[model samples]
Every structure is written in structure tokens, then in C-alpha cells.
Target: MPTQPATAALFPGQGCSLEGVKPLVQRECPDLYELCLCLLDADPFERSGDSTRYTQPAIFLASIARWRGLVRRGVRAGAFAGHSLGELSALTAAGVFSEPDGLRLVALRGSLMAQADAGGDGTMMALLKGDMGQARVLAERFGVTVANDNSAGQTVLSGSGEALAASALAAREAGLRAVQLDVTGAFHSPAMRPAVEPFRRAVANVELGVASAPVFSGLTAEPFSNLAVELSEALCAPVRWRETTLALARLGVERFLDIGPDAVLAGLSRRNVPERAVVRAEELDVTA
Candidate 1:
């Protein structure tokens, strides 16, 4: 038998649409879909209308459903990594907790993050054609913070509405394209600090198990040592995705499977490690 490539399964954070995932989940993982409806008290398939409280759990269910399909096909990974909100999904996939337990935690995390920025004055913006140096300069000038280092060329900043606007204008003047993200709060910034302790306490209450595979932390670009503490701290820390991808490559991950609602992570993998094979769940034949 041909040896399987060293693979890492990646879960994406928010900003991608869950357009066709409902049908996929309903067809392949009905129990999880129903559980989502029961726990959330709404149709998980319906549009979230950009509400973080709804989008978080919806994304989690979609990712897990796709992962289950992969598992049925005997696909496996050596490691796993998730971006921001996707980390909870990664933990569940790695057997750190049950799916239902993960769902409940994500639901509460969403609610806390949403409530943390009730005024809705906090937002995030992406900076393109810029390096981390420029991103840091703009962030310092505007009193914002770098939320995600998605790739060498793409960085996201999070802060107050006024700060983001000022940062965007500065980025444009500096010859970088600035685009505002369709998110509800300044995630990975000080604006999310209010949710940190509550989320930490909630994570502590859950029963955690040894992961079936190593799960890398976006905050530290290393395998998780303390999930509860790291997960909560991740709320206000930058997603070192570029570094995380590199770390995975260092660990001999030659194939990256993006097991999420969309191809967001796959796209990032291509840019972050072009030599590696990147596959999206949608591209796989799950009918077997």
C-alpha cells in the first residue's frame, strides 16, 4: 500500500459564508444538525445576518460535519490547527471534547464575544500588499492591534470603528489595499478582553481529554499545552497563522486538508506553503 502523506487538517475562522453547508450536514451528519437546531433554538441553515452569536456555532457544526465525512472515508491527519473560532472545532476533532460539548462551548463563546462589544463600534479590516512591519506601524499609529497574520502579504487589524477608519486611510496612503471585514466585533483585540475570563471559566468546566493528534495553537504556533488558558487568551491575541503554517511544515506536514465550510484555509495554505499539497473538503469525493 502507498504510504499516506503527512497531513494536517485545518479549520477556518469567520468571514466565510456557510451557504451550502446545511444540506451537506443534513445529508451526512443529521444528528449533529438536529443537535444544532435543538441547542440554538433556530435553523442552523438559515442566514445568521452577520450575528456572531449565531455564526460561531453555525460554522462549528458545518466544519464538524465535513470532518465526519472525511473520517468515514478513512482519511486521517497527523496534526490539526484552527483559526480563531475554528480552534474549538479543531479541539473537538482531535477528541479533546465531545461534539455536543464543543457546540455548547462555542455557543456560549459566541454570546460572550457578541455581548462584549454591544455598542458595535468595534470592527476589523484586512491589509493587503503589506508586510508585518507596515501592519505593525499602522496598528501602533491607530492604537489598534494586529488580529491575524494570515500570510506574508495579508494582515488583519482590529480596533474601534474610528481607529480602523484611520488605519485604513493610512494604509491606502501607504500603497496597500484596505478592506473592512464583515464581522461584528474587534476580535483578537482589547475589545474582546471582556469575554476572556468568562470563556476561560467555561472552558475549565469542560472535561478535556488527550488529543488523538497534535493540535497547534494559533496564539503560540505550537502544540497546545494548556487548552483552557490558551483558548481564552487567544481571544485577545493575534492569530499567528503564517507562523503556524510554517511550524506545521517543520513538523513534516506535506498535505493540508482544509476541513471547514469554505476554502479559506486552503487558499492561505497555498500562499503560506506553496510546495505543500492543499485540498479543500468540497473538492473531495465524499460519496463513497
Candidate 2:
């Protein structure tokens, strides 16, 4: 058996992009194009270049492909952590499901989340260095809501754009680092309640198996071998990413690998785990 890595492999969530990835797939692994197309059930490359539905699966395909390529080069992971949608990819890589099932779940997730967006014009903001206690107080004052309790120092607020903007300004005035996120809707907030039932029903229909490695839950900050119900709730739950990272670090994970397109999670991990070594596999140049 291959030796397990001392690090945890991290996968990024929604904001990761797939630009210029199709050409790489076509050039290096022509076989993947047809397989991915079949999974998408449409000509995503020809249609709207960067639709969320297309981007979601595209990121999954690219991330998993990178993982396979790395394994082909003899890299193996011992533990896994994925941000939001990346969790499914991490689960799939850890043998919780086959690629086809992972693709199906991604498709269902994208469609259901799109439906959730139609419920309201809500937005998300990342507030840095703000008092969680005071932020909650501010949210209550403005009728807004706390969406993501990400790290010890970071929390995300969600509400109508006007409301979010107002809250952000207030936070900034109060000396907090606040910035809006570029997302379709206020995900992980009560605003996504409209999508919960359909997404939950869809996930319950899938069969999830046990993972070979420890998969940390961003919602519960605990390890879960069961993927179905927990993953469904993660779609709209406050991502306890900071807690997850700290917990993983406590388990002697001194090295971290971020397997997704962007380095956001890796960067966040660097900030959160300054004592650890972090490697972003996808960001590295691929061998010919």
C-alpha cells in the first residue's frame, strides 16, 4: 500500500474558475472532454462561456483531473477538506462515490442553487477582524443575518445588497475589514431556504459510501464518514472553516495541499496556519 501523506488536501468551493482549463484537457487528455460533456449533458463550452452550472462541474472535473494526474505521478493524500462544493469533490476523491455519481450530484447542486437565487436579490460580505459578538449585534440591529462563521476572526454576513452594503459600511466605520463577495446569491444563509428541500431530496436519492481518509466537515467542525445528509446541509449552513482548519492542524497535519483551481483556500490556510507548509497542486505548472 502507498504511504498516506502527513498533510490534508483542500478543495476550493464556488469562486474557483475554470478558464483556459478546457484547452488543457483537450490537449493533454482528449478522452476527458467527451466524458465531461456526457456528464454535463450539454455543450457547455459552446454555450454561455462561464455559466455557474457549467463552471461548477468544470471546476470539479479540473480539480479531480489534477488529483488523478498527481496520483499518476505518485502523490497520495491522507486527509481531505473541501470548501462548499469542493467538499463533494474531496469526498469523491476519498472513494465516497464514483466520478459519475459525483458529476450527477454537482449538476443537481448547481440547478438547485440557481433556483435558490431566484428567491431574492441577496448578497454576501466577508467581515475581517470584527467582533463576532458585535457583528451579531449589528446584524440584529440592521435586520441582516450572519451567514458564514468562517474563522476565529472572519465572519460573512448575508442579506439584500442594500442591507449588506449598509452593514459593510457600518463595520468599516467600526474599524472592521469588510468586503463584498462576488457570488450569485447569499449562499449559506436563510435566504437559501427555498433551495433546501429540493437539494435535500436530490442528495437523499444518491448513495454515499465510506471514505478511506478522514473528511472534515466545515459545518460541524467534525470528521464525517457519511457523505449524503451532512453534505446536503452544508449547502446552506455556516461554514466552520476556521474551526475545521484548526482541528485538522491539531491532528498533526503540518503540510496542506489545496487541490482546486484557485489558491484562496490555500492562502486562507497560510494565514490561518502560518507554521505549516501549504502546497497548491493545481496552481503548479503541469508536466508535459
Candidate 3:
């Protein structure tokens, strides 16, 4: 029989929707569910799910809950990676901290990012059918920042709304499709600099433990050498997700399990490693 491929667990960022994850969290991780309710003062998935203050914690809780379910099913991963805000979930799942700490950190991060973007004209847009080279050219021409290198063909730009709009026009003119993201601010760019120091302090206070499995940073595509520093710097640094995905592949990850509410990371994995197996949390029959 052919050998089963090695697996890596991936977590999604703010793009994840909380549509079907509430029940899973309630069922598999009631403590997390209750904690989220207490932290946010409401069920984020049921309340203002679009707000960063709610979305970040909601996704973190859902991802961790799914990770717990995977653990119960004996699903082991050789490594882990998360996109943007999902990095906290990855670290927690890797045993760097307790789930409660992760949840609290995520809540603070969301609140800080939201406040940083408050009353600002910052936003994000996706450049599709374009490579990093083209994205860089647009960024240079329009004074935007390459926020997310999501895949070979999809890169996200973040900056002032006017700058992003101009970049979007230029991308479309260059035959690439540009779509505006629903985020409230220019995340992963200079606009988030205001939140960096505060988040850094919060991360520093947390007691971090060595990870059970290597957790690659989306900011650098490397195993985390210093959690507090990297997590803080990641606020304004681009998410090098494409590089991180390739790094996992180079590390012999032939299967990717996206332990988040949505299959967004699984979709990105397919784009990065088409020959490899990609599975979403929803696909696993963990109910047994």
C-alpha cells in the first residue's frame, strides 16, 4: 500500500465566516464557547460578525475548537501555519499557550486593529491573475502596500482608500481583475502600525511554551524564533502566505488540513500544492 502523506494543519484569518462553526465550538469546546461569550459580551458569530472586534475572536475560537476536535480524532500534524490573524490559533494549537490566553490575545488584537483603523480611509483590495512582480509594480505606482501574497496569482494590497482605488484601476487596465476586500482597515500595512507596540507588550506578558510542532509565521515563512516579536511585527508586515505554503511543502507536508470554519486556507493550499491532498475541517467525519 502507498504510504499516507504527512499532514499540516492550517488556520484561516479574518476572511473566515462563522456561519457553521458555532455548533462545532459549542459541541467540542464548550469552555471556549463560554469564554468567547464572556470576552466579547455576546456571541460574535451571532452578533456583529463583520466587525474586527468580533470576527477575530470568533475565528480564533472556531479554529481552536476545530483543532480540539481533530485532536480527539487522533489527527496529528507535522507542522502548522495560519494566515494573518489566524496565526494566534496556530500557535495555540501548537501548544505555545493555553486556549484562554490565545482567545484573550485575539480579542485585544481585534480591538486594537479596529481602533487603529477607526475614522481612517484605509482598506484592502485583491489583485487576481497577477503575480507578486505585477503587484509590486502597482504598489510602487500607486503607493500602496502588498499586504498578502496569498497565492501565485492572488495578492492583496492595503493602503489609503484612494491609493487602493487607483491601484485597482491600474490592475484592471493591465488585464488583472481587482476586487475590494470587506475589511475595515489597511491591515498588514503601515496603517496598522499604531497597534503594533500595544500588541507587542501584550504578547510579551504571555508565558509562551515551546511548540509541539513547528508553527511557521505567515510574516516570514519561518518557524517562530520569538513569538512576542514576530506576532507584534506581523501587524504591519505582509502575510507571506504563498512562501509559507511552499515552505510547508518543502518540509514534506503532502496533506494540508485546514482546521478553520471555512475552506479558504484549503483552497489556497490547492493552488500552492495541487498534487497534494487538501482537506477542510468540515470534510472530516470527526463526529465518530
Candidate 4:
């Protein structure tokens, strides 16, 4: 008998684009593209670029299209994990919601997030060569929030522009690369609080159920059993990507497939769990 593959599908959140993905899953999985047309009146994969509103749905399609391709090739991962917006993709892939429904939810999510951006001077910055302790120290000192704990050496700080600028300066002074993200608002921070209620309201209209396959939650860094509250709380909670990936590794996931636009999560996994194999699903020769 063939050995079971100890693999997991990793989905990425925002700040990652799928401007020109390979193999062009659009021709195959037109459902996502059609939904993008319905929602934005444009092909997100083709024109989204870095706009937060368009990027959300585009990333979903980018990730889900690869997921559909994997399913066609009979590659079934033991578990699924997503980092933020990726969580919704995971939920959709696990069948918690229909593809169209998932796209709709992400569209509304993107809009609310855009509104939050226009509401104030929010921003996000990346801290290179910083660990949890150092990031927490900076967060406290600069009054910023840890938007994403991507890896041991990389953390994203989010909050008001002033705080982000100050935090970036501090990182540079400490011999760290501080790069401001292309995103508009301070996602995964208290600055996103305003977007939460509207988002919650939107999710309420959409029916959510338990996923058919186990999905690791970005909020709890564990398998998600509930959707309603976890998603609501996800708004202001930092993405625990490092711990979440480690949790999958502990669960015997020897390999990780980043089923999304960029190989970011795969790269993060390689660095965070160097012993594990990480690759983008689309790049894999699924035909073989």
C-alpha cells in the first residue's frame, strides 16, 4: 500500500497578492472568477494588485483554485490551516460554506476593512530579525499591536501611523529591517475594532457550520470547532502563524502545501519548521 502523505494545506491571508499566478486556474475554476465579477465587477486575479478590497477575494480564489486542483489530483491533506483571511479559505475548502458564500463573506470583509482604513490613519509594518519577546517589547513601547507573528524572525506591527512609524524606527535602530506593508489599515489590531461589528453582522446572515475536515484556527492556534465567535474575535486578534504551523507539525504534518498566490506561508513554514518540507501546491506537478 502507498504510504499516506502527512501533509497539510496552508492558506495565506492579506498582504499577499496573486497578480500573475501560474497555470491560470481561472480557466479551470471559473466559479471564483465569476464571483469576483459579481462582487467587484472586475476579475480580481487580473487587476486586484494590492488594493485591500480586491486583494481579499483574489487571494481566496488564488488559494481555493489550487485547492480544487489538488482535489482533482486526489491529493487529500490530513488537515487544513489558514493564516487570517486564509482561515475563511480553509473553512470554504473544508465545506463549512459554499464557494460563492465564502466569496461573498470575504467581499464584505474587505469592504468593512476598507472602511476602517478610511476611518483613521492606520498602518502595518514588518519587523525583521525580531522574536516574540522583542516584538512584544516594541509593541508595548511603541503602543502598537502584533498584527502577525509570522515567524521567529518576522513580526508585523499594526496601529496608528504614528505608532507604526515609531516602531519601524525602533526596529531600524535595533539593526532590524522595518518594512511598511502595502495594506491600508492596521489589520489584526485594535484599530480594526470598528470593522468587527459590521463584519459580525455580515457573518450572521451567512450560515456557518463545522468544517468537514479539521481546520486550524488562527485565533486559538488549534482546530476550529466554532465559527461564529472565532471569526468575530479574529478581527482584533493577532495571527498566530508561528504557533499554528508548529501545531500542525506536532500533529504529524511532515509537509506543508501553501495553496495560495505567493509561497509566503510555505516560506514561513520552511524557516519556522526547517525540518519540514514546504512548497506551493500550484507549483507541484499535480499531474504526477
Judged by lDDT, which candidate is best?
Answer: 1
Displacement of residue 241 (Cα, Å) in model 4 is 0.6
Candidate 4: misplaced stretches above 4 Å? 286-288
> How should the candidates be ordered by lDDT, best one leading?
1, 3, 4, 2
Clashing pairs for model 4 are none
- TM-score of each candidate structure, all chains considered together: 0.97, 0.88, 0.95, 0.93
Per-residue accuracy of model 1 over 76-138 as CA lDDT, tens digit each: 989999999999999999999898899999989888999999987989999999999999999
Candidate 3 segments whose C-alpha is farther than 4 A from its true place: 1-4
Q: Candidate 2, which segments miss by more than 4 Å at Cα?
A: 1-5, 26-51, 282-288
Best of the two (1, 3) by TM-score = 1
Quick one: ranking by TM-score, best first?
Answer: 1, 3, 4, 2
2 versus 3: better lDDT goes to: 3
Model 1 earns a TM-score of: 0.97
RMSD of 4: 2.0
Error of 2 at 264 (Å): 0.6
Residue-wise C-alpha lDDT for candidate 3, range 140-189, written one tens digit per residue? 99998999999998999999999998898889899999999878888999
Which of 1 and 2 is the better model by TM-score? Answer: 1
